[model samples]
Target: MIEATNTDLNSPKTESQSGLASLDPRSKILLACGFILTLSLLPPGEFLIYGLLLIVLYISASLSDCSPVYLVRRSVIALPFAFAAVTLLFTIPGESLLTLPILGIDISVEGAIRFASIVTRSWISVQAAILLIILTKVADLMWGLQGLHTPAILVSVAGFTYRYLDVLRSEASRLRTARQARSATLSAGRGGGTLLWRARVTGWMVGSLMIRSMERSERIYNAMLARGYTGEVKTLTRFELRSRDYWSMLVAALTAVIIILVAHFL
Candidate 1:
């Protein structure tokens, strides 16, 4: 029953305080991106390789102080959608669970296997993404994207969007509380409103939030200007890959290469 709006991006859980914080952001980014790319590009039928990758991710998440429960909970949210798409595979005509006469559709064993493979791959991929967010700060993610040659405008947009989302959310929460307080005496059944009235209220809320955000942006710009702001953001700490970083990268690369070779041979 936890509302999504109550999720705080800035609050670091106990898992965030693990060894991951000690590693350079660059290393975390490289490892995460490399693993994700390999998983996505590799054949989903390579169960061995997928299993190894999942283990690696679990270890990394553990070292980072991320709770396995939290990771699993967040990752499982996508399972329903994946399940829906794969469910159709069981209904296709072939050697499936059962043959149906109503719709000349045949379900095959291959389809069921493929469906299972897709589900496993989807689960692993989602977990990888969640781990990435857990290990790397949002600012570091933006910086990493920049380093990877992402467009400046796109990076700027992402940065601004992340910053403003919290502001807007806070405003919305405050408004909701105020509304609840004012309507405390109203019966729940009578609280329903006309579509037009609801639309008008939503529009007003959006307009007010927009104005507040703009004003806040102006103030931020002025503060930056006073501090001799430049177009480039400079980081206080320079990222240097240590021996462990190279070792980690080497291990991941070797695993990927082995998987590719096995897939080709088998």
Candidate 2:
């Protein structure tokens, strides 16, 4: 079995020194879930509420020693996925905003508002999750999940997935190195292969990687079984909630409640 590296098991110096990062992972997890849930509950077109929540997110980012620009850049990853909500631009019933020139579809004002809300909600939620990931090490995260009564099997799977992503990445790197060593370049310094040939080679590389990964995984599993890994992730550090943890949770819960209440009442 592969040994966990410090990079995998240990929190970074920045996280260790940050105030918010010092909180128990359980508290962070709960706060993120509550924030996302609150965002989901807000009615469509609650742009003011969304903007306020974004301010809260940025404040948390600053508390954790993360850059607001970096957080925003990472959060933009959700936008492409948010495009799935585009159909809502025509599906929701309301006054027509404009007719599409090509599709001849009339975009409803309500649908546009709903789509914007969905995109904003998704972007904010992803940033919240990214903050959690940035602050906690994988081992600590897994331990926190276990402590929070997350199912053993799911926690185990998550732990393995996080650990082996680096393994898979290393294997891919090796494959790329080997490919480059073998690949020829043309006089113009471009790759020698035609488009189709390059595609075929890429497919072959993928297949080879999959086969090798499967074989290695089988050996790793057998070795793990010999070492008594029974689908339970164990950590040396025990997670106990402190006063700060409770206080943080309380503040987050109250903030979420207030946001929800304001969204509804105001």
Candidate 3:
């Protein structure tokens, strides 16, 4: 969803393109995918390799001209999802480190390592994604996906989602505002009511929102059909891979493989 951010694909002459930005979006997308796959396939507890991949991620962020603050802020978005790995700390069987006081659950050393690996990979993947989005504009990225022969339906869905996301956000805001006008006068405690009441209200709100969204979507689809929208979405230009793309891919794939080999052997 980096498309939600402000990034210009078209710029006048004299704009500097260095490092990651110098590469075509399709090349970069494939390179990033390869790098992530390499990282994911590394043996568990290969901390040395993981550390090396982390360095590569930092280098990528720097090459994209990403501010450290912005990178950290964006990276936090994936942390909540990583918390699912925390369950592994208790689920995996191994030597126990500690037992829960009441339930008597054990935390195993192997499980801790596994959990850490999961979280580390998740963080690395998010950082790499953010770097790619920062360096490449959404339009180019979408075009790159099309060039890569990604499913046309998937591409169209992504395009439409990004296009109408802001409209959905606006609708949500209006819904919340309408609710707040009445909620402000109520004595409901945390988040507007008792837990059970809150659940009921939430369900009601969600149902209303769904109905409104469906109606709006139906109208939009009809309007588009009236305007003669075909099933295919077309872009102005078809991007071609260059010699630089081959070199970049070779370098990225080679570097990742070398790191994995070294991490495995040493």
The candidate, 1 or 3, that scores higher on lDDT is 3
Residues 1-266, model 2: lDDT tens digits: 12322233232335454767888888878888888899999998999889999998888888788876776766666776877899999999989999999989999999999899989888888988878888877788888888899998898888778878777867876777777789987878677689899889879989999999899889989999999988665678777899999998888888888888888998
Candidates ranked by lDDT, best first?
Answer: 2, 3, 1
Q: Quick one: best lDDT, which candidate?
A: 2
Task: List, residue by residue over 136-228, the lDDT tens digit for candidate 3.
Answer: 777678888887899989988898887777787667667666776666444544466677986787688888888998999899899988988
Candidate 2 least-lDDT 10 residues: 1-10
- Please tell me which predicted candidate would have the highest TM-score against the true structure: 2
lDDT of each: 0.72, 0.82, 0.76
Candidate 1 has its poorest 10 consecutive residues by lDDT at: 183-192
Model 2 misplacement above 4 A: 1-13, 177-203, 218-233
Please identify which of the two predictions, 1 or 3, would achieve the higher TM-score against the true structure: 3
Cα shift from native, residue 175, model 2 (Å): 2.4
Q: Name the regions of candidate 1 deviating beyond 4 angstroms.
A: 1-7, 10-22, 90-93, 99-107, 181-191
